[model samples]
Target: MVKFYQHTFSFEHAWDNVTYAFWLRYPNPFASHVIGCDVIDRHVDPDTGVLRTTRLIHKQGVMPRWGRHLIKNADAYIVEESEVDPKTQTMVTRTKNLNHVRVMQVEETLTFTVHPENPKWTQVKTEARIVSEMRWGLTGRVENFGITKFMDNSVRARKGMAHILERLRHNAALAGTPVAAAATTGAPLDC
Candidate 1:
């Protein structure tokens, strides 16, 4: 069985700042489970002028009592791919687990763009799919667990982004530049 989840939310920050915050979202207080993240490849498309990045993330897994026996290693590896188009002012990111596909697989995609009603704010749309093919009548229970864990992780990821955005705003303020302007000017923060 497969479980799907979708959510739409807004960040009270400019789209540029929101996208920038995404790069620094890790190591935040809310995402303590994220142990390490590394950029495997990054480049700009010369023809389209879009920046593309591929990253690998290592996260410590937290399994339920019933699931502990299913998964031997309490760790997960995720692959994240993202594209940023400055001309269109849009960013799209997709992430999925690279391991433990037999037990369960969780895939997520997020899109960021300027809010329609408020240009100063950014809108984010999130979509996720969870699937489990475990036999012995464990498919339903495993899929349920996958969906619940995905939702909880989504909340933490948002909080982590917010924390980074606030820090960027504070630093921009101290530098006598608005966050929006800093994003446009590519001004470096003193942090």
Candidate 2:
């Protein structure tokens, strides 16, 4: 079975600074589950003037009591691929957990673009898919659990990014430098 989720929101900051904060978001307080993040590869595409990046993230997973037996140790590694097009002012990211696939797999895609209503704000779209390949009648249960857990994680992830963006704004203010992509609260829609 497969489960899907989608949400749309805007950061009252610029696309540049918001994307910058995204790169620095992992270590924030809201994401304590994230232990380590490393840039595996990064380069700018010569023709497109787009920055492409790959990162590996390690997270200390948390599972429900019923899931403890299935996911021993509860540690996970995530692989993330991203593309940032400076010319177009857009950023796209895809991520999936590399381990514990037999039980459940969660794939997420996030896109950031300059808000149509306000150039100073950045618009964000989030989409996720969860699937469980398990059989023996466990597939349904696992998929359901996956969806719930994924939504919870998504909330935490958004909060983490928001925290990082705020920090950037505060630091920029302290340093007395113009924030290139700083964001503030904007019209947000979650569904």
Best by lDDT: 1
TM-score of each: 0.94, 0.92
Cα lDDT tens digits, model 2, 1-191, are 78899989888988988888888786888888888888888888898999899998899988888779887779899999999998899999999999998899989999999999999899999999989989889899999988888888888888888898888878879867666623322312110
Report the lDDT of model 2 for residue 133: 89
Model 1 residue runs over 4 Å out of place are 184-191
Candidate 2: lDDT over CA atoms?
Answer: 0.85
Give the root-mean-square deviation of each candidate in angstroms: 2.2, 5.5
Clash statistics: count for each candidate:
0, 6
Native-to-model Cα distance after best TM-score fit, residue 184 in candidate 2, in Å: 18
**Candidate 1: pairs in clash:** none
What is the C-alpha local distance difference test score of each model?
0.89, 0.85
lDDT of 2 at 41: 86
